[model samples]
Target: MAWAGLQTALQLIYPPRCLTCGGMVESDFGLCGPCWRDTPFIGGLVCDLCGTPLPGVDDGVPVHCDSCMTTERPWQQGRAALMYRDSGRRLVLSLKHGDRHDVVRPAAKWMAHSARPLLREDTLIAPIPLHWSRMARRRFNQSALLADALARETGRTSCPDLLIRANRTRSLEGLTRNERFATLMGSIRAHPKRTALMEGRSILLVDDVMTSGATLAAATEACYASRAREVCVIALTRVANES
Candidate 1:
């Protein structure tokens, strides 16, 4: 009962609070009710390739967005837990910039639920890596934490360094798709010693957010270069707007 006792003492020391408003919450890692109501969780219909919300006319069948229909994604499939807006934005910011370690468990649980369709028993879970410069600033790669938690939940192997960010790329905030391509073209590579773990493997690439998707795209290329048989992506949240 030491673990239980420790949990009780921790709870007493730090009462649960909402990640957004700092109001007391029922659990240690979630938003309050109003914040929960405001979250744009991605459920129901979404693009089969990129997990963008669809128009809801397909009656739950796999459908592609106009972008996915015209263009191809490097990964075979993708899923996202929420649209990056409202409380969804707060959740991501809390985890990534706020140093809210409490949010990882809840976020990972949501991601695991969203990614269940793409997961296989043998699939390898990996995180999009941070460049050394960025990692030194952030102190940790948030994606690595999520990838590790996802691996635990699914009983899959988590390869935190399978894809290494060899170089840092400029922020993709307002870049067009073509411009984004040039920016992230050679930013990532498969780790030399760990590439063998990816040979002919199905990989589930994890990340905190899919903004322009440049990061995931570059990471996917790294995985395929290592002879991974297939790759699927699961972002905790994704940019909601096409722009």
Candidate 2:
């Protein structure tokens, strides 16, 4: 009863606001109705490999997208919470560059829902690693934050430093698929000290966004090299159409 009273008092002092619009919302870490409608939360049929939304209904059978058909994905399966557009884009950029730590909780909830199919008793959660130089500039890895929060929500073990960026690579902003793959080919590897934790475990790699999936491929390969029994991936958002 004291806690309830305290919560009521706190709500009076600091009312909840929408995550994207800053409009008053009923609860914390939520979007206003308008923003929620605008956000492209992925659902229905999706690619079995990368989680891109498909045109048909989910028939209880896994299907691949056009991109996944031609391109190779190192991970066994994947899922994403949103399409990288509209409010989804805004949310990811805010978390990545604007230091919006509050976004982690809600984002992790969505990711956990999307990743329900991929979870296992022996699963270990890890993030796509950032280069030390980049980490120094950014101060935090958004992916790691998401992975840790997701682990908490899913009742799984999280290893934030399971993967390390062995080589510093340039940004992949404008790189083609081939170039992006080439740049990240040997850039990521499993941490020597954490390799034992991954052995015979199903690794669930988390990332803030999936563009060309080059980074995820690198991270998945690293997990495989560490003798992980299987690897699956989840992302906060995915670029619907790769250019």
Candidate 3:
């Protein structure tokens, strides 16, 4: 009782701050009221494949977004916990470059909750890997950290070694779909030693953000090449091409 009370007192003295704005929040890894409202949580009727927010609803039928209609997505289903906008960008950038390891657990909890529909009995949770050079410079792979947290929360196998980055590509931002695909082709490959583990298992690819889905597609190609039964992609944030 004394220890619990002392801990509560300490918490009151040093209240948890919002992850986005650093304002005092009610809980750890949470947001203040304004920040909470500002967050663009990706919900509502979304695209069946790319998970982009749709304008309206339908009669329980799956609706494909404009990109999905013309472009073929390698993953079976893609979902993002938040729309990559003001708050989402800040949150992701903080995690990616700011070394904010505290954000992974809560963010993964949100991701696991939002992507629950894609979870299956034998899903292997994996991350879009970073090349050794990039990982060395960054000191960590943010996607791998999130994947590990997500696996712990969802009770899936965290398979960081399932896919390996064979080569590094330039930033895909501002590139067209074809250009992005061309750059990422042959960049990612499944680890030969662990390829057999993915032979008949479903894979849930976790990442920090999804912009053009190029990385996920390439990673999916690698996973499928190893005979994985299914590949699904989910991220903490996704760049919404439209409203």
Q: What is the C-alpha lDDT of each candidate?
A: 0.87, 0.95, 0.88
The candidates, ranked best first by TM-score, are: 2, 3, 1
| Cα lDDT of model 2 by residue, 1-243, tens digit | 999999999999999999999999999889899999999999999998999999988998999998998999989999999999989999999999999999999999999999999999989999999999999999999999999999999999999999999989998999999999999998999999999999999999999999998999999999999999999999999997796
Q: Give residue 224's lDDT in candidate 2 (0 to 100).
A: 94
Q: How close is candidate 1 to the true structure, as a TM-score?
A: 0.93
Task: Give the range of the ten consecutive residues with the poorest summed lDDT in model 3.
Answer: 234-243
Off by over 4 Å in 3: 1-6
Ordered from best to worst lDDT, the candidate numbers read: 2, 3, 1
Cα-based TM-score, every candidate: 0.93, 0.99, 0.94
lDDT of each residue in 1-243, candidate 3, tens digit only:
999898799888888998888998877778899988999987888886777888886456778889888788988988888888998888899899899898898899889977887899999999999998998999899999999999999998988878899987898877887898899999999998989989999999988988778889999999999999999999999886632
Which candidate number has the best TM-score?
A: 2
lDDT score, candidate 1, position 107 = 87
lDDT of 1 at 92: 85
| Candidate 1: 10-residue stretch with minimal lDDT | 53-62
Cα lDDT of model 1 overall? 0.87
